[model samples]
Target: MKPGTSTQSALPKLVTCPTCGGDSVYAPSNPFRPFCSERCKNIDLGAWASEDFRMPTTGLPEDQKTDDEQ
Candidate 1:
Protein backbone atom coordinates (compact mmCIF):
# COMPACT_ATOMS: atom_id res chain seq x y z
CA MET A 1 0.00 0.00 0.00
CA LYS A 2 1.26 3.44 -0.92
CA PRO A 3 0.61 6.77 0.83
CA GLY A 4 -1.90 8.25 -1.66
CA THR A 5 -3.30 4.91 -2.83
CA SER A 6 -6.21 3.14 -1.14
CA THR A 7 -6.30 -0.62 -0.50
CA GLN A 8 -9.08 -1.42 -2.97
CA SER A 9 -8.91 -4.03 -5.70
CA ALA A 10 -10.28 -2.92 -9.08
CA LEU A 11 -11.95 -5.87 -10.73
CA PRO A 12 -13.77 -5.70 -14.05
CA LYS A 13 -17.43 -6.57 -13.69
CA LEU A 14 -19.48 -7.58 -16.70
CA VAL A 15 -22.32 -5.23 -17.62
CA THR A 16 -24.65 -4.75 -20.56
CA CYS A 17 -23.92 -1.66 -22.68
CA PRO A 18 -27.05 0.44 -23.00
CA THR A 19 -26.33 1.43 -26.61
CA CYS A 20 -24.92 -1.76 -28.17
CA GLY A 21 -26.28 -4.49 -25.88
CA GLY A 22 -22.79 -5.86 -25.35
CA ASP A 23 -20.58 -6.74 -22.42
CA SER A 24 -18.86 -3.83 -20.68
CA VAL A 25 -16.64 -3.42 -17.66
CA TYR A 26 -18.33 -1.70 -14.73
CA ALA A 27 -15.35 -0.56 -12.70
CA PRO A 28 -13.80 2.66 -11.50
CA SER A 29 -10.81 2.06 -13.78
CA ASN A 30 -13.09 2.34 -16.83
CA PRO A 31 -13.73 5.96 -17.79
CA PHE A 32 -16.92 4.96 -19.58
CA ARG A 33 -18.17 3.15 -16.48
CA PRO A 34 -21.17 0.99 -17.50
CA PHE A 35 -20.60 1.56 -21.21
CA CYS A 36 -18.09 -0.58 -23.07
CA SER A 37 -16.16 2.25 -24.75
CA GLU A 38 -16.25 5.88 -25.80
CA ARG A 39 -18.29 5.08 -28.91
CA CYS A 40 -21.02 3.29 -26.99
CA LYS A 41 -21.14 5.97 -24.33
CA ASN A 42 -21.38 8.68 -26.96
CA ILE A 43 -24.11 6.78 -28.76
CA ASP A 44 -26.16 6.53 -25.61
CA LEU A 45 -25.68 10.24 -24.97
CA GLY A 46 -26.69 11.04 -28.52
CA ALA A 47 -29.88 9.06 -28.12
CA TRP A 48 -30.73 11.13 -25.05
CA ALA A 49 -29.93 14.37 -26.84
CA SER A 50 -32.03 13.32 -29.84
CA GLU A 51 -34.97 12.22 -27.71
CA ASP A 52 -34.74 8.61 -28.85
CA PHE A 53 -35.55 7.41 -25.34
CA ARG A 54 -38.72 8.50 -23.63
CA MET A 55 -40.65 7.87 -20.45
CA PRO A 56 -43.92 5.98 -20.66
CA THR A 57 -47.13 7.85 -19.95
CA THR A 58 -50.85 7.39 -20.11
CA GLY A 59 -52.45 8.04 -23.50
CA LEU A 60 -55.05 10.35 -22.06
CA PRO A 61 -55.10 13.89 -23.37
CA GLU A 62 -53.79 16.55 -21.05
CA ASP A 63 -56.95 18.63 -21.28
CA GLN A 64 -59.17 15.63 -20.47
CA LYS A 65 -57.54 15.04 -17.15
CA THR A 66 -58.62 16.77 -13.96
CA ASP A 67 -56.07 18.65 -11.87
CA ASP A 68 -56.17 15.93 -9.23
CA GLU A 69 -55.78 13.19 -11.83
CA GLN A 70 -52.44 14.56 -12.91
Candidate 2:
Protein backbone atom coordinates (compact mmCIF):
# COMPACT_ATOMS: atom_id res chain seq x y z
CA MET A 1 0.00 0.00 0.00
CA LYS A 2 1.65 3.21 -1.14
CA PRO A 3 0.78 6.69 0.11
CA GLY A 4 -2.00 8.44 -1.86
CA THR A 5 -2.82 5.13 -3.59
CA SER A 6 -6.36 3.81 -3.26
CA THR A 7 -7.59 0.23 -3.25
CA GLN A 8 -10.38 1.17 -5.71
CA SER A 9 -7.82 1.20 -8.52
CA ALA A 10 -7.02 -2.47 -7.94
CA LEU A 11 -10.54 -3.81 -8.61
CA PRO A 12 -13.09 -2.57 -11.10
CA LYS A 13 -16.54 -1.79 -9.74
CA LEU A 14 -19.25 -3.86 -11.38
CA VAL A 15 -22.50 -2.14 -12.30
CA THR A 16 -25.61 -3.05 -14.20
CA CYS A 17 -26.09 -1.42 -17.58
CA PRO A 18 -29.33 0.55 -17.68
CA THR A 19 -30.14 -0.55 -21.22
CA CYS A 20 -29.18 -4.23 -21.23
CA GLY A 21 -29.24 -4.98 -17.50
CA GLY A 22 -25.81 -6.59 -17.77
CA ASP A 23 -22.59 -6.29 -15.84
CA SER A 24 -20.45 -3.27 -16.70
CA VAL A 25 -17.30 -1.77 -15.31
CA TYR A 26 -17.99 1.44 -13.47
CA ALA A 27 -14.54 2.90 -13.86
CA PRO A 28 -12.58 5.28 -16.02
CA SER A 29 -10.97 2.32 -17.79
CA ASN A 30 -14.32 1.69 -19.44
CA PRO A 31 -15.29 4.46 -21.83
CA PHE A 32 -18.88 3.54 -21.24
CA ARG A 33 -19.36 3.52 -17.52
CA PRO A 34 -22.58 1.87 -16.31
CA PHE A 35 -23.10 0.63 -19.87
CA CYS A 36 -21.81 -2.69 -21.13
CA SER A 37 -20.85 -1.39 -24.56
CA GLU A 38 -21.25 1.43 -27.03
CA ARG A 39 -24.23 -0.34 -28.53
CA CYS A 40 -26.09 -0.26 -25.24
CA LYS A 41 -25.08 3.34 -24.64
CA ASN A 42 -26.27 4.35 -28.09
CA ILE A 43 -29.55 2.54 -27.61
CA ASP A 44 -30.19 4.53 -24.43
CA LEU A 45 -29.35 7.73 -26.27
CA GLY A 46 -31.74 6.84 -29.06
CA ALA A 47 -34.50 6.25 -26.55
CA TRP A 48 -33.90 9.68 -25.07
CA ALA A 49 -33.78 11.31 -28.50
CA SER A 50 -37.04 9.58 -29.48
CA GLU A 51 -38.70 10.67 -26.19
CA ASP A 52 -39.13 7.07 -25.10
CA PHE A 53 -37.92 7.96 -21.62
CA ARG A 54 -39.81 10.67 -19.77
CA MET A 55 -39.69 12.39 -16.41
CA PRO A 56 -42.63 12.19 -14.11
CA THR A 57 -44.81 15.30 -14.13
CA THR A 58 -47.62 16.62 -11.93
CA GLY A 59 -50.01 15.95 -14.81
CA LEU A 60 -51.38 19.45 -14.88
CA PRO A 61 -54.11 19.98 -17.44
CA GLU A 62 -53.30 22.08 -20.47
CA ASP A 63 -56.35 24.23 -19.81
CA GLN A 64 -55.08 25.21 -16.39
CA LYS A 65 -52.52 27.96 -16.28
CA THR A 66 -49.73 28.33 -13.74
CA ASP A 67 -49.72 31.06 -11.05
CA ASP A 68 -46.84 32.70 -12.85
CA GLU A 69 -49.11 33.44 -15.80
CA GLN A 70 -51.51 35.45 -13.60
Instruction: Supply the global lDDT for candidate 2.
Output: 0.91
Alpha-carbon runs more than 4 Å astray in model 1: 1-11, 61-70
Q: Each candidate: RMSD to true structure?
A: 6.5, 5.0
Clashing residue pairs in candidate 2, if any? none
Q: Compose the digit string of candidate 2's lDDT tens values, residues 1-70.
A: 6797879668888999999999999988899887999999999999999999999897778899889877
**Candidate 1 local lDDT, 1-70, one digit each (tens):** 6688754455457889888898988887789978989999898899999999999987877579877786
Structural RMSD, model 1: 6.5
Highest lDDT: give the candidate number.
Answer: 2
Clashing pairs in model 1? Answer: none
Candidate 2: stretches off by over 4 Å: 1-8, 61-70
